[model samples]
Target: MTRQHVLRFYVALIAALTLGVLGVGVVGVTYLSSQTLIRNLFPAALLIAVSWYGSQRRVLVSESDIWLMGTVGYIATLVLLPFPLAVLAVAASKGLAEATLLAKKQRHSWKGVTVNAGGTILGVAVGGGVFASLNGVSYLWSHQLDSVFALPLLLVMILLYNVTNELVVVGAITLTSQENPWSVFWRLSRAALIPEISLALVGIVFAVLYHSSPIMAAFIVVPVMFSLRAFESVATLRRETVEAVLRMAEHLDFRDTSTYEHSQRLADLTRRLASALELTPEHVEEIVLASRVHDLGKIGISNEILLKQGPLSEEEGDIMRKHPVIGAEILDSYSMFKSSVSIVRHHHERWDGKGYPEGLSGDHIPLGARIIAVADSFDAMTADRPYRKGLSVDDAVERLKAGMGTQYDPKLCAIFIQILMEEGIYAPSEAVPGELHLIAGGRASGGRAS
Candidate 1:
């Protein structure tokens, strides 16, 4: 589908989900005391605020939320309030979150808000319905319910809530992204399961304690939640920075009809290669981001020059070689991309110290840059360009081998080739990289020395 068609379709889907949830929620609506409503605002809005902050960061693949605080709010509201009241509390919190997002101009698109609000409402409704059906409200409201039984059932309730939200959000993502539903489901099935469970238990503990010691729960537990939020804040900032860099990168690729194919393919390959080399997750994420925007400096080059099909004149070559420096400088301006700047600055540097911008050779070059160099060259060789048909993947692999020593890091290139040969593709693998040995500055591991 065209971009407009996709947007129009998702808008309708979001509206439908929203309206349906509102309709079902009406049935659950009942009068709650003013005191209960007032009390819920504290946990609900505070959680929402933290959640609002957390939402600034996005995760990969399906691009759903990772709001531990928000999840806690839903579970807490369900455990503490009646289904109808919990629904309102959840809605109120979400409404407030939307407002905050809008006021700060932090929201990227209305579609994102719609998907978030719609999926959340539906999820809460389903979770509340399940909880109420299981006599959970009775247990929660009663003063004499046994702790042992309540705790176990509360776990089930939390699971139900989490699953309901996950399904609604994941389903929407599947439909929008056109990713395989089964594959998405399997990937997300185990994603954040532990964190969800742990947060649910925390919510249960809070609710149970709130009955007798509201102050303690509010003081101790809330602070603990804030601590988690602190970490999430750092992550959010990092993600937001990377996202900005990506937007700039996309703009560089936007004018062409290929839809950023070169960068995207390179990024994907580099990620697989990084994994096979036993790089840490953070290292992998940085490498992937760097690979995607490694050529970002090309945007600064003149289109007439960049579009030239044949070999460039020495002067033109000099201009082209300036991209790494430009890209690195552009990235360096962003504090979050400091580490990535190193990779971008050095991606063109060769094993033999004969490449552009910097002539750093061998182990002196950043490992991530080495990885990107290989992936970038492979994708460039295998992807069709204006000048010529691309090479076959096998031929591309052979080309990589041909340049293995002089152009790329021998170890990283070998690991990438080994992994590719073994798996036949960069498909998801349960196999971890062989093993890793600590390298200089510990940026990239030596990985069992090949």
Candidate 2:
């Protein structure tokens, strides 16, 4: 099915399930006393609303996993309110909070609102219904000694709620991206497992505190939200630092005669090839960043060597070969760039142990480095330099095929070539036989090595 059709069906299914759950909840509606309304119900709803607002102050741990506060509010709401009230409170609080916090363009469309609300409702309904059915709600609602035994049930509810909520959201992502649902689910689950469990425990704490004194719960939840926002600020600053480094790398393009925007183009290609290989989003992001700074060590090379128009002498070649090591050292100074260091340091490493600062071969080379090598060579071969005209796309493809398992990973080369062909970027008919002309030293001057 088409992506849109899949998304539509999935969203419709969530909406239907939400309506059915609400219908079941309506049949068992129990009126709250004035004291109960003032003490538990009102406090639960307000806590959820506050928590929802706090949840918006989040940090993105990965492309798919967003870590946030406010599970405390949802769990507390389920603990203190009836099944129908808990579901409605979570939906209303979250939807309203997002509406208030998010910009118009960020919301995408009203369908997003429906999916989010429906998903939360299903999560709370399923988890709360299960807890109440098992007679664990009484222990949770009252500050009783028996609450110790009910803790396990609360854990189960949190697990069910998180799993149900995550499944609903991951289902939408899978449908829209046409990705394997289990893969998407696993990535999201693994990324958020610790934080989700921790937050669920916090929610249970807040619920227990409320049973004793609502004012005490309020004091606790507020500080927790502020702590979350503080963490969000730190994450934002780190991201800005990373962006600043990327900008610096881009500026370095001006330092060379034949390598302008070379890193940028490689980064673009790396993203496509990495994603095509079904790598995780975080892995794709890391490789793309690594490709952008793969040649960062070149800053240490002399201007004459960097801008040389012909093949280098043995001595000059040795100096040029030090760049990958130099680049890795430059990045190693910064903890944020730790992940990219190996990739930058080893991008020149060959598949058959013939290339590099290190003579690592085959699977010994880091996967990110291997991916960057193919992207680097392709960009270099297709790009015009001071000494020679760039090869045609077909010629570059031919070169890549010829180098497979020697200069590049055979599997990666094959995959990259297929991607180029499918994208219509390489036209075989336009290729000329002499386009693969060798310069002195059996290498194309100012090409891949540059």
Best by TM-score: 2
**Model 1: lDDT to the true structure:** 0.67
Model 1: per-residue lDDT, tens digit, 1-450?
643466468667766866776666555553556776677756655545444444443333213334445565566667766677667667767777777788889666677677777767777777667777878767655768443455556766666766666666565555554334554554455555666676566666666666566676666456545647754665677678778888988997656645487777777889887766544344467678778778888888997777777999999999989989998889889865666788898999999999878799997887788888888887788788887999887777777767767898766776676566556553223433343112111223332322
Question: Candidate 2 residues 1-450, lDDT tens each?
Answer: 644666688788888998787776655445545565465556655767766765675677434335677676788778867666677677677777668655645566566666777777788888888998888887755567876778889888988888898888787766554446776687567656666777777677777777678777766756576657755675676677777777766666687845547876888899987776656466577778788788777878998988888999999999999999998998888755777898888898999998888899998888889999999899998898878999988788889979987899876776676567557786556432332322111112222110
Ten residues in sequence with the least summed lDDT for candidate 1: 436-445
Q: How many residue pairs clash in each candidate?
A: 0, 2
